[model samples]
Target: MIRTLYIDEMNTLHVCDSPYDIEVTPKWLWVDMSEPTKEENLLLSQFFHFHPLSIEDATTVKQRPKYKEYDDYLFFVFHAIDLRTMKPEEIDIFINSTLIVTYHKEASEEVDKVWHTMLNKKPNEKVTTNEVMYKTLDAIVDNYFPFVYDLEDKVFSFEDRHSVDISTENLIDETFDLREDLLLIRRTVLPMRDLVYRLLEGKVLALSKKQKIFLHHINDHLIKQVEMIESSREMTADIRDNYISLNSFRMNNIMKILTIYSVIFMPLTLIAGIYGMNFDVMPELHWKYGYLAVWIVMIAITVGMIGYFRIKKWF
Candidate 1:
């Protein structure tokens, strides 16, 4: 999908399909493309003079988060977190004097919302492209908190439900999965955070006063997002440790029970072994009264052992 916006005035912006060009004032124009093809790439390169290396990275999926300063533009690659599954999708953004291009391997809900907000109004009622960019970045950052909060919630849920029946394997896997997602989010957010920080710090030459103010707003949002990601990562680590401790406790309890059972039965086993031995000269085997005496003795021994175990609190 490709969306092009040409902003001429505050309320009047033009929306067009991709693979097309128009000459407008040195105003803010934003173009977004997803899963571009060879023909689309060729068209963009012809019109924008985008660097070959930047185009290569844009075309390839799963590029790492980075920033490349070209002669006339800034190329940035970042990932958007998928809140439902805690995965990251790579997104590429390029900015020059009058044009901003965004490339993505998959659809971003935040991007789509920003695009619609830009195009829904008449040209005279549209917002500045810079402001639109701010909103786009803001939306992406805004989404991060919800995902991080959800991960935190999951960690707490796991900790609260710790039990012997719960499978440690699954819990550990989930903790690692949450941690991986937080790391991916951090990779994207941290660089973008730095970029916004530079803008807030007045380091970028491309931004005008109005654009800088808008970028500063985006910077604040990014800062919060990065903090949330970091906090969530820590929460996952804590949950993992809790799971380990719970499992160890359960194992120790099981071993204690088995050991106590073995100890309690040792004396009974010894007495039974002695009686079962075959000996023709055993005097008790031929006496009728002796059989009764042996039964009484066995009962007495069993009761004594039970009382001793009770007194020792071994149960």
Candidate 2:
């Protein structure tokens, strides 16, 4: 579907299903194409004459977040995340002095919102393609916050559980899943942050001071998001390490106890082995008091070993 929003010379807002339906020269024009068909996609070449590479990138479903500056316009491959699944929704943008075109394979809530706001403008309010573009970008960035904060809260909760509940089931799996989610969010946010940085540093947009400020504010949000992602990633790593370390410590304690038992039993086993041997050299086997003497010897050995172990604190 293709929706067009344009402002006439009288600064009145108008909406049309097709850009060709608008007769007057618009002060600013916005063309939003949502899942356009092949014929509708031709508007890129027949109407706007965008570069083939930019058109291809725009039509494609998944492109990394980036912006390319052409001779007359700038093309951007932006992503809005699916908050429920943490997947990216690609939204391509083409912007020049008087026109802004948004092409997306899927319907965009952010785009719809900006479109609505443009349509419902105050009588005296002025709108431009740049302002519309900024609003869309801002809306996309704002959408990220809820997902980020939710992930952060989960990470915090998982960390707390890990601290107090050592036997919690699937702890490692949960940690890894959280890390994976953070990684996905980071993939979208990092490139977006770079794209915004490039927009701010370069003169491609010809933005007003206020617009630049607005973009800067978006950049700040992106920075905070990146920081949050990194911090969460670190927390997950710490959790994994702590879990492994705790298991190792428990294993060492178990091995220590087993070793102490083996040490105490070694002499008793040796004494029993000698008596079990039937040979001519076993003279004590026939003595009347031999069994008693053997019992006393074994008991003495056991008591002596226990005393030595206690002195050294081996147990």
Best by lDDT: 2
Q: What's the C-alpha lDDT at position 213 in model 2?
A: 90
Residues 188-255, model 2: lDDT tens digits: 99999999999999877788889989999999999999999898899889988888788888889899
- Worst window of 10 by summed lDDT in candidate 1: 122-131
Clashing pairs in 2: none
Strongest candidate by TM-score: 2
What is the TM-score of each predicted model, taking all chains together? 0.74, 0.92
lDDT of 1: 0.74
lDDT of 1 by residue, 177-292 (tens): 87887786677778778766765665555677777777777777787777777777777888888778888988998997788767656776787787789988888778879868
- Runs of candidate 2 with Cα error greater than 4 angstroms are 278-280
Model 1 pairs in collision: 11-123, 11-124, 11-125, 11-126, 12-123, 12-124, 12-125, 13-123
In order, what lDDT does every prediction score? 0.74, 0.89
Error of 2 at 115 (Å): 1.0
Distance from true location, Cα of 288 in model 1, Å: 4.6
**After aligning candidate 2 to the native by TM-score, how far in Å is the CA of 287 from where it should be?**
2.9
